[model samples]
Target: MGRRSLSGKVVVITGGARGIGAATARALASRGAVVVIGDLDVEPAKETAAAVGGSGHALDVTDHAAFSAFLGSLGQIDVLINNAGIMPLAAVTEEPPETTARQLEINLHAVIHGTRAAVGIMRRQGSGHIVNVASAAGKFGFPNGSTYCATKFGVVGFSEAVRAELRGSGIEVSCVMPGMVRTELISGLSEIGFLRPVTAEAVALGIVRALEKPRFDVFVPRRLNALTRFQRLVPRRLSEWAMRVVGADTALFHGASSAARAAYETRVHG
Candidate 1:
């Protein structure tokens, strides 16, 4: 199939205020698409919209009413990008119920809710694209990040099911599994010592590529895809051991906070 052109397409993106979401909005708008951006932060949303010459609205992806209203306002959504998420560090038992719930709400349920809302509109139009931003963690579980992994894995699974369900419907669903991308999410990791990163622009570039090709899944660098696959095949015990040896805290996915640092200090000093 010939690649689809983004020209004149109507795209809606969550987390569009900054990071990958903002970059994606610009990327699509640059291709002449009309973009409707939704973000919890109105200031950044306005800035991104101004830069891209598109529309921006304040929204929390977890709120069903807010999401519906955002979509209702657009009336037509050609591309839907579910890009809002948060990672808070916690051991399984250490995580507050609220933290896990919020993560599930934003990272997982938002995708479910967005897919439902967008599909209804797209099915009516008979043409659209849905891009759900997942991560390498989605493919292989990380210790201390079990909840985060579960949510991202749910994204991959949900995208697959709907993609197959929507086959030949003039609508396509693509899951973008990005590795480390330089974004504000990093601020959540100040206590962490290691840094491996990719720029939001680069991740955005990969997303645009995915949009054109409409692939089932997109992994930035492409090579990382193989590494994730290999990781998935490794025994859980061995993988966990290797992760500890390298000081690769799976908790990194949940993210670090001053509070978390204080807790760690208490544990160490006590």
Candidate 2:
């Protein structure tokens, strides 16, 4: 495949009403890509789209047919950013089963549905890019984010397989692993000494870079890839001790305040 410019390309971004998704929409739109924002928050999506001189629509990623229909309405697409995800932090035993299930449905299953909807169109066009946003937890597990980690790990693995399967077909797949972006998902959480969250704008740049370079995986901050690979080489006991030393072991629990938990519960149940 040849290197392509984003200018004038039609790009669709899921969950584009806020955070990294919204940032990506703004960045890509500025680069001349025709951006389309989709989210359950229809009004905000429209507002975001209007701000970027794009368009917005309501989309429930869990519904497979809705995903396909939205993609079909676009006619032709140059890129699809599977950016819709939710992170509700809780200890495995203390968390509600329904909440965990909902997290998986949104973070993992929705990405799958979005990819399935876009892959066919891209394959037929013989040119496109698919960017899936995974997290640092996707590469390594933490105490309070088991379910979120599971979903992201699934995304990493899924991206690898799909990239290989689509090799030489002109459709490229990129997995973006970002560490602690300052997004709404972690909003209201107390700032920790060790964890410095980057801006959503930074991660958005990483996504755009991945699309231009067509790499299988792009880690925001770049150094995160080193940490992710190093974790795998060390023994489990040492890794656990390292996590404790860095205060990652308790970061999620301490950060997930009662209000945050309640907010998630209200969103999922109501």
Candidate 3:
């Protein structure tokens, strides 16, 4: 199939002030897409947008009304990337109820709402794409990140159902599952053997490639897709064993105590 041109496409991204979202904005802009960023930190968002020659707005993804208003204000959205998410890792038994609720709101509910809003607008325009950024945790459970895993799992399922519903509607849906990314989100995370964290720009490029060639499941490193598929074919016990051998079991727990994560944890939890 011929590659689709992104030139002049109006792309909207949430949580685009930094990390993967910001990287995606810059990448898409370089491809000639008109990128607009919405983030809670509006100043950095504006700066990111300015660097891409796009507009920026303050958006709290949890607020449905505000999110809707923000998208409505943008004349036409050819692509909506539901990239706003938070990861506050903790054991399910020790995780705070508030943290669970926040994760559900930001990681799952916001994606749902953004996709719904974009669908309505895109239906009228008759062409659009929605990218929901999930995580590798969505596919495999990890210690000290039960709730975070749940929310991402929800995103993956939700995106799948929506993609089915939007078929033949000229609206493409993509679910992005990236492994541990080298960002503030993993500030204190220890490296896992063979599963070392990837750069945000790598994930950004994955998103860009997905846009250029519409695919349902987008794995950042690409090899992860094969690994995940192979995981399902193995016995559950074997899968668990592999997880342990890779140190995926205690990475988050160790990160929870790391002083390097203090600032990020405080900002998210507070």
Candidate 4:
């Protein structure tokens, strides 16, 4: 596909305050996409929106009503980026109920709601794109991030289904999966991973590419696709054994929430 132009396109990124959202919002704005920063944090969202000279709205992904209202406020959106999510970092059996619920609300449910709202407008307009920011968790399902994996998997599945359903509708949906990104998500990693945690800027550019080409699925860097394919092919027994031996689950648990972080800190530091 050829490099597509983003001039005058309107993009709505759900978690536009920091990390990937902020980076993507900026990247798109620079390329001619009028960005809309919607986040729970007002100051950060406003800052990013102002930087892009677009717009910002303090909105929570999980709040269905508020999210719909916020979408309505934006008038017409050419692109919708579902990027808000959380990793609780707990063994499935040991995971807290609240943490799991929170992850589901933000990750899976929010994607569904956003797609629903976006589809209505996009289909009517007959030209739009949706980008769901999933994770390598959706592909590999690392040890302690089971719930997080579940949600991302749901996103991937949802995106595929939506794409099939909207066959000739000009509206497109893409699942943008990123691997071990170097961001707040992995605060303590410092710099060690299968591939040095990729930068937000790199991820942002990948998203922009996806919008221009309108693919149903977009993997970051375009290189991780093969690795993800290999991860899926490994026998389950071997995969679990290797993960346990390497303490992968424990690492994910610690990488999640502050409560999990505290517990993880005690275990790793002890």
What C-alpha lDDT values do all the predictions have? Answer: 0.80, 0.85, 0.91, 0.81
How would you encode candidate 4's per-residue C-alpha lDDT over 171-220 as one tens digit per residue? Answer: 88889888767666676543334445788998898898888777766777
Q: Which is superior by lDDT, 3 or 4?
A: 3
Write model 2 residue lDDT over 1-270, tens digit each, in one string: 675589999999999999999999999888888999889889999999999999999998888898899999998999999998888777888779887888788888888888888999998898899999888888878778899899999999988988889899988899999887888777556655656678899999988877766787788878778777778899989988877877777767765776765676466443
**Candidate 1 — number of clashing residue pairs?**
3
Clashing pairs in 4: none
Candidate 3 least-lDDT 10 residues: 248-257
Q: Which predicted model would earn the best lDDT?
A: 3
RMSD of each: 4.8, 1.7, 1.0, 4.1
Q: Is candidate 2 or candidate 4 better by TM-score?
A: 2
The TM-score of candidate 2 is 0.94
lDDT (tens digit, per residue) of candidate 1 on 164-208: 999999998889887667776555443333325678888888888
Candidate 3: tens digits of C-alpha lDDT, residues 36-121: 99999899999999999999899999999999988988879999999988888777888889988988999999999999999999
TM-score of each: 0.87, 0.94, 0.98, 0.88
lDDT agreement of model 3 with the native: 0.91
Give model 2's clash tally: 0
